[model samples]
Target: MSGAVPLNDPRFQTDPVELYRELRRDHGAVAPILLDGDIPAWLVIGYRELHQVTGDPALYSRDSVLWNQWDNVPDDWPLLPMIGRGETSIIHTTNGQHRERAAMISDALEAVDPFTLRQHAERLADELIDSFCADGRTDIIGRYTMLLPVRVLARLLGFTDEQGPGLVTALNEMLDGGEDALTGHGHLVEAATALLTEKADGPGADVVSRMLANRGDFTVEEITKDLLMIMVAGHQPTADWIGNTLRLMLTDDRFAASLSGGRHSVGEAMTEVLWEDTPTQNVPGRWATRDTNLGNRRIRAGDLLILGVAAANFDPQIRTDSSVLTGGNTAFFSFGHGEHRCPFPAQEIAEVIARTGIEVLLDRLPDIDLAVPGEALAQRPSPWLRGLTSLPVIFSPAPALSPARRP
Candidate 1:
């Protein structure tokens, strides 16, 4: 632990893949690290190591209450929002209770009509494009990618369209792990509470209503917390997936054919992004339930283990040919792995939203190209999630599609 790295090091925000390589070389799979405020923890960067950690729920638990550093953590710590404790949400639950909660969530999400989901995605994408189509130039991140997922998700979750913007603001601020994180969390809780109250009297054909109808015997507070979990888990990562995939399609020559009309490669580009530039870079994390060994590091009971998702994807042991395209290879840890991995239904929903949004953008603006050099593009400054701050692009001006013409 002599050269323990700080997780908040600026290098992690910019060019993290290289930093991951350095960490892997210097510390092997499990490296001693410091979270914000110099609190010690371990980062599991090896692909095999990460798989083992996530697969064994009994050994490496999701229950943050088991963390040994809580006593030293200040009440005002900015990271408290990201590393929450004593929450009754599905993310913190274990054993039989966790299974019940997970079943409720999966059932609700699985019931989403696939055709309607695509329709919502396409219509929302078209509406966003209509806002900027006449200008011939726009920052796709701020104007489109960042807004579309939350808007589409809001509609599916029974929130009014007017509520979408505020939700986006709060979700981003909370996920950014900054000074306003706690405040952002407060806004989300307030919004969820109000929405659940409204849904109680009158259920609808939405995820929230469906969860309410589930026979889980969940209380208002429990459902509200789970709703917040779903919103936070569903929004930003999907947005980043669209952004990263679009960036890949624009910058990489392999996908250049799609920019001109060959849309067949869109799925391939998206899959590649999962292996290369996943949205959820580093997840926080599994706590060691007892003394154990991982990747040559001795982990003590209650030790924090941060999942190095992006790092594991780049692990040389598994990725023997780093230069080779990851065509159809879905083994990457982006959506996570094992028992607590993202639900299959939720994964399907994210894919529909992202893939539909990308396809709609390409169909609407076939000639779009990056306005700035690809190297000039910068990433958002957060170690936990990886995405662009903005993706400026230009295309020939076109008239907006009339409402009659919209599908």
Candidate 2:
């Protein structure tokens, strides 16, 4: 009735749905689990209970300062990269301060015109697709998915050529999470430090510039960390979301048929991906502010709480199948909820990027098919995120989109 499963266990990473589903069925929604360091945490897997925990900050808080494990866990614990963090993390902040920081980001994102966003998305997608479209076979991960998000984020942030790659690499390293995580985090801080320095001198019409001007009383160091959080949030998961959605389009028969029937919108397909294969399987950790109960499980003070985003989507508490009905499915935990909800609709952003890239490429090369069988496809081994390392596909060589469509 009570036990712990290793968060980094191979099956949890490689085949999470089946693995966590069993955890939900057997462990009853909230399963105490072990992180990489044998550190303890609770994994919330049921839809209703996850909502209960996430929506009520009075009971569950993201303030990492409340986390009790720090007393027992080492300062250099690997889980710190993903779970707990400094005072500046927008993702880990709460309530009024959370709203303040989120507003700064939301206002900056709102400044980017929809038309201009799409125009840049299409141009970037077209150019990248063209580079590999001629090869007749390509790895979508490198050529398209991984690069598209960073490119768009760079333009939105007003990053120069040098700054773009620096941000991307640093962000990737942080999320990639291994022996180099501390180094990667150092690089991210360095990149953010430089950007903050540049913006302070002579601010431009960009997200960073806007954030700097709008920040109420955030110190420069705090603003730098906030920017790093925004950059990583904007690019990494969205890139993975696109890749997961693209793979669904290629492999799922029902999804593939929708393209021929003209029955599915990019948003619809993207929603389905989020339901079945959320980009973030587990998300920013929450700590119980006081002793509480969640789905019959006693949550003690300072206990770590992780919403099983992917598990909640499929939990019997909600019907995922109803997504096929007309109006579209809204029941998803991919973007999270409550005071900490992602201000920008990540799916909408992913849709904008994926639609342009997928549509432009599909229009040019219509017959692209997976080079390997669907069964051969495998997700990379990370407990917190679901993503394909690559989706190899073959298609008849087609001429690149014309300059008019491209630029």
Q: State which candidate has the highest lDDT.
A: 1
Q: How well is each residue in 1-407 modelled by candidate 2, as lDDT tens digits?
A: 14788877778657776787778777898888887777788899999999998889878988888887787777776556777555567887787888888888788777777788889888888888888888999998878888888888787776775566666667666776666667778887887788789888999988889888998888888788777777777787888888887788888775776455443555667778778777888885888999989989999998888888888887865764633532457668888888787776444565677667667666666777899997888776666778887889999997777787665
Q: What TM-score against the true fold does each predicted structure earn?
A: 0.98, 0.94
Model 1 C-alpha lDDT per residue in residues 201-233, reported as the tens digit of each score: 899899999999994677989999999988988
- The ten-residue window of minimal lDDT in model 1 covers 79-88
Clash pairs detected, candidate 1: none
Model 2 CA lDDT for position 397: 90
Tell me, by TM-score, which candidate is best.
Answer: 1
What is the clash tally of candidate 1?
0
Error of 1 at 216 (Å): 2.2
Task: Tell me which residue pairs clash in candidate 2.
Answer: none
Off by over 4 Å in 2: 258-265, 320-327, 345-347, 402-404
